[model samples]
Target chain A: MARTFEFHGGVYPPERKQRSQGPVRHAMLPGRVVLHLDQHAGRPAFATVAVGDSVKVGTPIARCDGMISAALHASISGQVTQVDRHTITIDSDGLDAWQRLTPLEWRTASAEERLTRLEHSGVVGLGGAGFPTHIKARVSERQRIDTLVVNAAECEPYITVDDLTLRQYTSDVLEGAQLIASLCGAKQIVVGIEDNKPEAISALRQAMAESQPLSVTVSVIATRYPSGGERQLIKTLLDRDVPDKGLPADIGVLCQNPGTLLAALRSVRDGEPLVERLVTLTGEAIADPGNRWVRIGTPMAALLDEAGLNRAALHQLIEGGPMMGTPLADLEGVVTKTTNCLIAATRKELPPAPPESPCIRCGACEEACPANLLPQQLHWYARAKDDAKLAHYRLFDCIECNACSYVCPSHIPLVADYRHAKTRLRHQQLETAKAEHAKHRFEWRQARLDREEAEKQARRQARLARQSTQQTDSQGASPQADLRSLRIAQTAAKAAVRKAEKNLARAAQQDPQQSHDDLETQLATAKENLQAAEARLAEARSAGEPQETP
Target chain B: MSDAFSIISLLSAVAVLTALGVGFGALLGAVSERFKGDESSLVEQIDTLLPQTQCGQCGYPGCRPYAEAINQGDAINKCPPGGDATITALADLLGRTPEPLDGEAPSEDLVAFIREDECIGCTKCIQACPVDAIIGAAKQMHTVIEDECTGCDLCLEPCPVDCIDMLPRSTPLAQWQPVTYPHQMIASDRRASMEMPHGTHL
Candidate 1:
């Protein structure tokens, strides 16, 4: 038995995963599937198929738009019913056909080839984050990764999809882990499983013994809620703290969920895109509580109904687990790449939170925080909308595990406040960046205008100087020359006025109904110029210079 | 003979004190010249906090001019496009109390739209635009680059045919952010119940 390490504060939530334990069952095909383009964390994928097009299972419906995004494939043979900005709806034809990529020999394939396969297969972190796996694996290019931590903790209560995945396909999971380790040049693999899942641990251990290619070790950690978190698991397995606002790769360690590893394996070895995943359907309101292999884009209501959901007894329908799951207000919501578990909990089973009260200033919340954050202070600052104070307190480090909210004596939703504050802070940062960009553009435009103005002024000065030199050469230094030039300028201004008046008249006659405002303004400016020219000529004449009409 | 010696000693002491005063004054002048703070950089710092709309609602020609005026003890609440946020930022930077906005705050961000068919091709709006967001030639239909438009509304008055319309900016679906936490459930549920074409429940 390998010695394990301890993380910071954590709580022991009841492990209600026993009810969901069984052989994984294949869910019925959904009549219609709604696939969101932005199922992954980064930029949304671009739709490749159009409406009225037919698609077989595993057919590419959307292609990755950027390096951080993942491709999307059809989960069932279907006709594209609608293609919109956010999602693509496909109506199944009940064929359950296939269109798959070419499988690759993971051991013999080059690292680049295996990575490309992973990128094209739409594999993401199935532990609920939905981060594109290829991007995470590509971190090896910048940093030398030494350890690959296989997270099998499944620490959240009522979530047994990972456990069931390990029990059913233990060797496949290990093989996926080894493939990723080789891809990242990692020398050792560490499987971190909480002691609560004895079956999963035994299966993992037996699979490791059967085919031991790389150095593998199983670290059975104590059962604790949220121990499955990436940061927490890494701390327990390797005792390495992922730095503030940094990734696991920064410390030469990469943590991957077991389900995500299996998906990667299926994509490379079986040439199958990530179309289906095992989802845990449990809670007291469910008649048949067990894990089922659900297709992506299946409607939540249909899956719950198939699991014998008692609507009358169901108080709330959570999309993940009790500790971190989001409450589903609408049953029509469809599953995506991140959907892992659906808990149709009864009112008594998961009671509604009591009304919030003023904080008693007790240290219970601080003690329960897994990230060692001061929830009480954070709650106050978040409510006050004090961004500076929240930043100073390292608000971004919060994993939003709801541990503080669970232990709050005042029943305050600390995690909710923190989430709101984080969103606001992020929005503020984006706005500041935009403001800075606009300033730069404005300044650049100003500088260009100034330079153009200076050039024009310089050109006008040179023209004036050249004209004066020509005048000095043509006419001897005499007052009559100045008078003659003034008279010439007056005549030219008079001609300009005549031309402006004639053009304005023509424009008015050409379009009787059109407003001739621009033409009128031009004529008015020309008249003003003629008046100034006449004034200058009169002044020259009064100066006693001979006025010669040219 | 003793009185004559005292007068000579007093004159020598006065000469030494004058030399010391001049020497210390020269050193102090050199130090001040070498370590003088850059005043324009202060103006630059203030300008960064402004929204850079260049709308001239602050009685200045542009954001930089307003930043200069603020550096010279001008009020920090005249920017309507920046609104109270800019005022608060300026106040924080200058260590002064934030004042209420001097002018009516813009209700929402707006971008100018040219009714292409109605445009007379005067190019007045193009010239009036401070950010050069509008692109066109003389006697050619002008259009606003929505992304670069600051929504300053400076071109509205210069448009001779009244073809320019200031409309609320529309956010693309890709840029739309989902509300988090407590309100997320209700907002997403409402969106689903309405059966909006885009059925993303993130």
Candidate 2:
């Protein structure tokens, strides 16, 4: 029985799914693989292996340095030929020359040892972002999580790699999920599968019954555009609205991808690091499009060719699902750990969108938005270049699910508009930050200039006093000159006192309760100013001139 | 005699006041309409949001005229700079927000950087700039008016030399959301396994 959901705005988009669903097939590995450093969203994994070093399949090539990054391994046994700014290429050691063995049996090691091995295996969240699985396990353990959610939603249209994986490797996926649950010390596990795939759900249930943990539950969720979205899936299955900007872990829950769990099980039980993944190759233009087990760092062109697709038929080769995928400008770019699906389509299969017409004030997009955002209003604010207004309408809340664009009768690429507007807003915000930093730099420069000017004046006053004292000694016999020197000293002291008082005044404005030490410093400065001013006044009086005024 | 005198006086006072006030108020509103212009006010505001670049990026003759058409309930987001933001503003003005201008246009902070080495001096980018930001003779390398450059990136398409590259503006630290959103972490973690047997929970 297929599970369906309510309140979802999805079109029965023509599923052109005929190309590659026959049987699981493997692609020929390339002689040289270009592994991009920043394959995932987080911190790019730093390359641990150097050029000229020989690495075997499952050899740790890059190590995770931060909480966000993932570790990388050599997909094939090869010599590292080139590591440059954009990519790292490994020329395969011809025909598996290095040792390639099956994953070790885990029963040989204790649970703690097994866990340690899993951590050292360099396994990350293979489902997509490549977050370190070990880190997540640690989080789950800390949170005292009671349940682990396994996502087999696979909601993105035309992408059935996960569904195919479950069909073939349901037991493996379950085992991976169980291993993760054990590591996290979770009590219950729930695998949420979308209702569209009844066979996968039945296969999962059958695997669970023969399995020991009679407690694992499988729930069929309604199919929706974003039902596959982690937050939405969690909400639908658990009835928990993960607080905006908060993680599932915050709510004592953790969700893992179906593929990631399988990888984790293999890593923990089999002692293997992730080296390859199942990539979905589906699109109307392709001669053959289906799920194929592909090695990481496989060139897209090569993968398409392996899938029996002719490049001439494919007008565009896109990375990921048709709805939210990015168009690959260069097929030379190799697949990374995050490459889940590669869709190859001809223009005729998915025709170019019609020319955009003026909005007739129709509210179709808002009605279609799953996030409950006023997409129409957002578009308006976005069009006006008003970032503030866009923010006010909660533009950041838009998940870019493409449902809005899918429903627009006018054929507007609504999601693209939101993305572009969002990108611009982010860029402007960055500019604002740079401007603020520049402002601070200018202020600091000005303050430094003021300090230097003050210091120069202080030095000049000291030098003048020294010269006057020498003059007084030289003119010791003249009473008038002696009186003049005494008066100059008094005036200088008074002037110093006045300057100190001004400093005190400014300080008082900044802080009401001046410390005794601060007050004393101010007094001292004031005394110096008073003395200097008095000295000049006295000198003027002794010289028979009018006394210097205060 | 006393009762007849009171009634007559009251009736006489009411009749005089009602006649004078009614005649005066009616005369004032008639004078105001004669001075008021018949031009529509809403059309002027919509014209401002149009890029005014007059680059024909919108497939319109000019921006102000496009605004006039939009004021009459045309699609928003025609201007690339205005992009989604403009659509939103127009939506605000017209009291409707719809996905209208979700089409493709270069809407980033991009200014044409002349590749000094590859300049054939075709002066094509200058002709393409709707804002007249590019200044150069037909045979000389052109310079972009940095302040005037809206970064619409219209010049990039027309460059025969392909010298113009729309460099992605650097995201300052403040605006850089941690590239890894939490949901991706959760999603990736849930389905990380590729080889698990069907229906089995880890």
Candidate 3:
């Protein structure tokens, strides 16, 4: 496919990729593995095995809660040792032998049976999308899927595990792609590789020719950072722009990373859950830099040591690619399901910063931005802390791709400004929610008071009527008798008024009122309500609970 | 006889005008170039606004390098920092229409504040900062120059500080731009939160 649109805002840094581009080798199992619960974007996995339980390699240690989370398995045979809020650390001690844990003998299951076994296994998309593979398989079964795009575009620099996977285990990667296509019932399969990895592509092509039909095709992508981004890759290969918030499925396309495909093949055929992953540990400062097929939950520091990168001279330990990666502080943090690369660099490989100066309105950032955004304008509004203007400009849609910052001549951290503004806006939203909640409570309280006042008025009217009837019967012609009863009723009403006054006073003390006028008005209404209620009660006594007063 | 006379008159007039025009053009070109000084300084100033990750997301090799291209009559809105804020600033500087900064950077309102506690003394942030604003060591705490910080936030991502939080700058009545100082002060700190680029300058 030809290059489509003018992608502005790009940087061409020194390609230090050869550091980890060699053959992918497997690292020996470590003594301990710390599996983080939240290895994916959605909900965390639930541990099926308790802390004291024994686990074997590919053992189902935990299960997925629902569609959002994936199940966890033991990468190595071990004993459940520790469980924290978000991670579980297992100690590897026994069972060095590769033995299948499934007593049901899942390997012998048919293709349909394999799909069933996978659902029970709780396998998810290990391609970093973390979508449950069973769901994808099931969805594919319903529709006539045209193609299965196997994303080998490990476009993020210093990440060549997929390349190594293709070179060393070419058969595995291809077989997995075929199985996924057959399972999903797709008509065609395309394994997208960035042009830089020609050897891997050739190896994959050779492997596909032996067993499967020519349905499996190898396509090369331009070597650009984030070329492996699902949407970007889809756009690059298919010339289709998946809507900003749309999925590939919406456009009748399905994409999966090479690593994720291999995992799916292993899970369906072997009845294995996602337990191990290929991690690329390389950087400039690293002493031994290459790709390592490590068990999930291995501490980054341990892998660093294996890669010969010590924590001493290291300047930064970033998870994933330099372009769109999270900077991790402690090297001791465990690798999760999505971690593809751990980049540790020195000052030389990644140079030290220059002093920041004022912006001179140079347009280089705009020209480099791939998304075609005006990075300069974003910087201006962000610097001024004008969040509203930022929102109006669709700040939320920014991919945080770092294109603007990379192209800026002023060394302005444009992305950082955008992030800060978003976070602050989120904080503002929470504050607003809290205030509205309080207002709702006040409105509820006011409604209750109104209802109680109306009830009291009805009772007061009934009581007065009853008193009049009782006076007529007791003192046929005696005005003096009626006078005495009226005085008694008046005294009772006065006491009721006092009680109402006391209740109002108590409420006032509990919550101080700044508007005395408002309080006075409320107090006056309460008193009037109490007076009417007392009159009704007096009448009710005289007439013995008078008939409903209209 | 008439044709010959007309041709000679026209030739003489054209020759005189051509000489004067060439002389004026040459003089103006010489004056402009002499006063322009070096364009590099302007590029250097623009480079400071970039984060300097050299990720090429902006289509340039690095931040400073992009600035040079900008001084050469490139579009001013490319740098995300000079986004809307940068555009307005550029308009103020060069007199142009202020366009909104592009939305290429997702959720662009983030700021980088070093989490002092989590800092591991790695000077990655300092090195990665296109502008050497972060000050710390291979294993010491780093501090940001608040006054000097362009608020471009490039330093945050490289911070081993998990600490470098991109806190959005809060706007108050005082912070509004096209900034008017020592003049009329808007009452109510309920300032408009806009998506502008870095720089406290109006």
Question: 1 or 3, which is superior by TM-score?
Answer: 1
TM-score of 1: 0.82
Q: Provide the TM-score of chain B versus the true chain B for each model in turn.
A: 0.75, 0.57, 0.50
- Candidate 1 stretches with Cα past 4 Å from truth are A454-550, B1-29, B96-100, B136-141, B171-202
Reference-based TM-score of each model: 0.82, 0.60, 0.57
Residue-level lDDT tens digits of model 3 in B128-168? 55434467887778877542334555566665537786677
lDDT of each: 0.84, 0.67, 0.65
lDDT of 1 by residue, B146-177 (tens): 97788888999988889989999887654455
Which model is ahead, 2 or 3, in terms of DockQ? Answer: 2
Which ten residues in a row are the worst by lDDT in model 1 chain A?
A: A541-550
Q: Report lDDT (Cα) of residue A496, candidate 3.
A: 56
User: Which residue pairs clash in candidate 1?
Assistant: none
Quality of candidate 3 docking, DockQ: 0.01
Judge candidate 2 at residue A269 and give its lDDT: 64
Per-candidate Cα RMSD to the true structure, in Å, reads: 12.9, 16.9, 23.6
Write candidate 3's Cα lDDT for A1-550 as tens digits.
Answer: 2343323345554446787876667777788998877676456788777788887877776777655566777877778898766777789985644444353333345667767656655556655556667667766654556778888887666678788888887887777777777777678887778888888978976877774643677777667755666666777777777665456776767887778777777776665667778888888768878887788888777778877776667866778777666766567788888888888876555543333456788888777665556777887887787877877777776777676666566666677677777776776564344223322222223333544664565566555555766775533221212435555755765675576577667766754422233344344544554455455444444443322221
Pick the lDDT winner.
Answer: 1
lDDT of 1 by residue, A373-454 (tens): 8889998999899988998888999998888887777777778788778877877776776666556556556645654554
